[model samples]
Target: MEGECIHIRRLTEGSMSYGNFYWEFIKTNTPVIVTGVSIKWECSNWLLKHGQENNIYSSEINFDYLKQQIGDRLVVVTKCSTHDESTVSVEMQFHEFLNYWRNQILSSKADVNNVTAPKILYLKDWHLKAQLPNYEFYKVPQYFASDWLNEYLEEHKLDDYRFVYMGPKNSWTPLHIDVFGSYSWSTNIYGRKKWILLPPGEQFKLLGPRGSLPCNIKEEMLIEKSVNFLIIYQHENETLFVPSGWYHQVLNVTDTISVNHNWFNGTNIKYIWCNITENLRKVMNEILEFRQYVNFKEDCQQILKCNFGLNISDFLEILCFIANSRLTLYMKRYRSKDMSGNRKSVNSHPDNFHIHYDLKSINMLSKFIAQDKIVFNCSTLYDRCMNLIDITQEIFLER
Candidate 1:
């Protein structure tokens, strides 16, 4: 029931190549803290230092100016938890949330072990990328840049998975998994956060009937030996990558602001596909009489599409999109006079490994998913995926 404790490590761009970045971290699905990221982002310095001297993260971000800039948009804020693992939230204009946020900062009782009055508030999942693209607050590091979810969403002209989070000390979100089993990365611009991360394959042991982790992560920490997890105290300007399927709880150790994105790429696509189909299958099996009706599986797929954002066919489309794009680029590269070299082990150049890895990985995934029972419901789309796979293999051999 227990797994190895997560390795606590840090890296800078100068420390390792992207090839090692993959084999050491991405391929192993481990969490790491990365630094020297070229995020020399002026937004962090500019916003953090509004006008007066700053506080957390040493930023001068002025309270009033920011309120004036983003106040009218509706924001979602949660009042401090009254029930275990269930915090109630309300939607109000951004300015209104900041007013309440200011009141919490003034009433903060951090010195007191427990302040029972005036519950704290947390503003979460603000779609900053869609609403404020010109901000250009940060750039994706090469280590985590192969993000297919955001890439696909952008291609379709939809809102991306990027989000901004802000909250005062004592605000927290309960333990939960990322949507669709996607990998996630979060970077703290200011203040620090305490993270409790549990590995995959162990969530069912902790999940309650409502499918959420219902116990206090702090309480669970008291018995950490019995329940293994990673305790990460993320600090200023540090980035944390959470691999697919990990369950995590985050608490603002100080007044804080951060940006995060959830993305599924070639590295974790199968995990994403499996999570969706398994959940859909569970819904169908739980309602047996419902299954006796005509086309029950397909009906369940429809419901899942509306709720979970994807089913088998849509998942295949993402794979094909990336595969074909990579194929096209590689063909161009192979035809060039520069690439007339012999094939070598994948442990070569950082960029070269990505090409070799992508070709083999995509071909394997396409073949495996094509044979899955869930693909039986949609013959035409599945056939197209196989054809795409064939094209991928053909182009790969031609190179």
Candidate 2:
């Protein structure tokens, strides 16, 4: 099957209100390149140096400053090679990677396209926020503050979805979806990146006969197949919002530093629920012979976590936390309603809209999952979720 090309919209900071953004991009599940939003971020100022290249101003990350801050910290580095699927990774101190980065830069400068031995090392998924809690690098923009995954993780002091990625030119990640089918936003602190993004479901077409997807996509393949995708050149200080389930491949066009987070909110919670259920089905099928065991459901949940990083119980806890929090806001807002018999559209209050929208979305998923006895086997949690949903509807919907 032939596919058409896709164009991603670009928006300036303050160009559109959060309401319009939520509807146009979030609700519609579209990709967008948002500029000017990260210009004033602290990291943008302190960690980068202003320079002019080809008569255009640009920001480059300061290697010296980065080393001073966290050079001794441990980091994971992936070694990528040209046309290779067996990428090896190692854990080393940050300073070691920096030394490698410096050497690679010098080598590339000497021979831009013909370097015989180039080290394509990428440092990714560094939990910088967890390590330096007091350091205020960049604040989460209001438009993305409804991140349930990070909010729950932060509140429980477990872990965060936020990450810092640094890689030299020629480093790239293969085509894949984000964890739990969550929406992801990546902001470039410095340098440029080339992103190849395919809309949801298009990736399945690229799968091989045995259900294996290529680790690295070839330019010839995209040309022969006429695959529909957006080729975005993300410049410095720009943020890219990738909607849920979108398959993307990122290559560092220049040595780049970026912060990325994977999160899901009411806008994409259905995708998260779908991902969990699909994985649950696969787990059950893999262990079909043991289905009659008394601990069958528990065993499935355990294996689900081991394989997919989340299970039914973990999902239910997240749902309850989000549902109860939204219910509290709804009740608080209900108490503050105008006493003069005046009412307004839900859209008039962004917070109120979020409360109502998130609660309704959560309730829909919770209700559906509650009926699945094989996966959602916890009776106590089910009752609590249903009670919360009932209270949410009674308190918010009536108004």
Candidate 3:
């Protein structure tokens, strides 16, 4: 049986209750479901029928066949899935097929026998434009521009921070937060999606051991964990609101079609900017390391100055802030009790200093000018350090 739709009343009531109980929680981050948003299923069916009448099947067609019929064009994956039991399991680009049909008729290749056939039937492209190594020759269609979705975007005031994601069945969007400084809402229009969410404090455990930046979880691990949570929905159009700072992984349970919008109002603008600044710092560090090893300092410096318009020192400060924040958050979550003990034992400098020998702490300090600079007087930084000590003390005291 199809899943029940998430009604407006339920959303309003639930958000109100949840918003109050978790007022601090919702202010920082939360997730909610909204239903009866649009008639996406009807639109999906309409596109499918149009493809059949035009003798066009996107999955069974190749780029060569399309080029022969319609020249070059952008083909967006509107639906996909690995579950053969699901109706939308087969991935297809309806608009691409439609474009091919129209071009074929204009080019007088309308005869069914004359149309070029592909050797491989299922020619699916799963990579998004940004994910592609080279985006010059490829283009992604904007499924978010559908009339129904556009209307919702207008009502919700999210027209600016919109993006389209297309993936094959069973593909995973790894655990990460969004960029562009906005809270996001993702809706499943054509198939099922399973999501596993982690609160901010819990994020350290999953990422720290892996030695990964918050934005860069290994895709394979994300896919495995998300599939384990596999939630199925055969009907009812629904959207999931993902508040700022919530780490989540999504698995397209079937060949799926979905649209996502990210929006920043007065509430989340500061936090969103903080997230972007953190990401930029990570990217800069990677570039700097590459330049040092490759002896391309001059070339890299030019790119940094010309492209990013930032000098090395300014960039280094940002990097320091991001690294300190990550370490602070990690230690706070994992070693808070030790922090308290160190505070109490400050008189015994040598003994308390031994805590600095912890590899993670040492490594973090090594990256900065000195321990003092590394632990600068930012409240978030200071709280994280104390929290780390507290966590460590609890563990050792137990032992």
Candidate 4:
């Protein structure tokens, strides 16, 4: 069977009014495909064949069985329902699965459990440790990492980023944005997938109780047209470049596999990191402030703005200043003399001013400041330090 043909168009000089058309898309928040570039087929085939041969039946797997199958280097996480009678299942990392199947034969233990229903699964970066299993199965990286993408990355000076993702079927990554401060182009090297994207300003409600780990919003709410941008495909060898700050959820439609590269060559890189750091602070504050509040989602959205700035890089230095100031305050509280040495003593204060920092975190903050990539005026940094110290002293004296 053949896939749908996508229109290809070369973006020549003065093709579309670059300023008007491009900026409009950013302003209106719409996704577009820049045609004319060729797609990669070899890498896609290699991935598909790898999955077909080594991917295990989701139903018949257990932690112990997988450990024996893949050996000790695997990181396995099992998601169980809150209800007692619910069935148990597991998801294994891609590298671990490959190590196990490469040396061993088909085992009888896999047949013991009736591996029936299919659940959401995710495998991250399976190819780093192993070469593409078979070239005939899917397109190779050489196809997509062509002159077009390479030239684009170079023109934008985005060569510093790394591409590290490997995974198999039944493993689905949670809905989230790309990491390491850049836009991402995710191409399906193996199977079909369903992608749901939430643009800036969309409110995605949380799935778990307030302050749960692996924070995720309900999938059902993501389907509403008013709240999400949805795309579904099968056996489609295409690349989708998602702009920075877009919230996305991906599901493997078959025993499929994929590879994605996140790059940070543009000004948007700094902004993306800023957005992530600010969001983390907001989440931590919400968890601390309203441990009792059930509607934490609404509260968080209220304070955040939809458009952080023109692009991620635009506000990189400023956001770094905010982040550094916050971290310094956290460190001062930990080193203060007034507080009892016990860590618990810091939390008993009525002002809710408790903060903590460790050596590794402090070192990282200092490095960012020293790089000058995140420049802060001397007065601003000094003011932040004094305020943090005063806040700590006040909290301790009140206690």
Give the Cα-based TM-score of candidate 4 against the true structure: 0.43
Of 3 and 4, the candidate ahead on TM-score is 4
**lDDT ranking, best first:** 2, 1, 3, 4
Per-residue lDDT tens digits of candidate 1, residues 136-235?
7678777887787888787877878998888887678777889998999988877789988887765566656787665566644424535667888987
Best-to-worst ranking by TM-score: 2, 1, 4, 3
Q: Candidate 1: which stretches are off by over 4 Å? A: 1-7, 36-39, 46-57, 68-71, 109-116, 204-212, 219-225, 337-356
Candidate with top lDDT is 2
What is the model-wide C-alpha lDDT for candidate 1? Answer: 0.73
Determine which window of 10 residues in candidate 1 has minimal summed lDDT: 337-346
Model 3 stretches astray by more than 4 angstroms: 1-28, 40-72, 75-160, 166-168, 208-210, 213-235, 279-399
Model 2: lDDT to the true structure: 0.79
Stretches off by above 4 angstroms in model 2 are: 46-55, 338-349, 373-378
Q: Please, what are the lDDT tens digits per residue for candidate 3 over residues 1-399?
A: 112112211242224332232233334455656554444333233223224446633422232532443344444432322222122233445455544434543444455473653111122232332233243322112211112222333444432334544343465554566554346666555556777655454455555465864443433544543322212232225667666766666676544556566554324534543453454455557686574565454454455455544434333333334334434644565454453323234323322323332323323432332233323433444445454444433334453
- TM per candidate comes to 0.86, 0.92, 0.40, 0.43
lDDT of 4 by residue, 334-387 (tens): 444443424344234311121322222223333453344222334454344344
Candidate 2 on 332-384: residue-level lDDT in tens? 66557631211243335567667767777787776776676653457766786
How much is the lDDT of residue 179 in candidate 1? Answer: 91
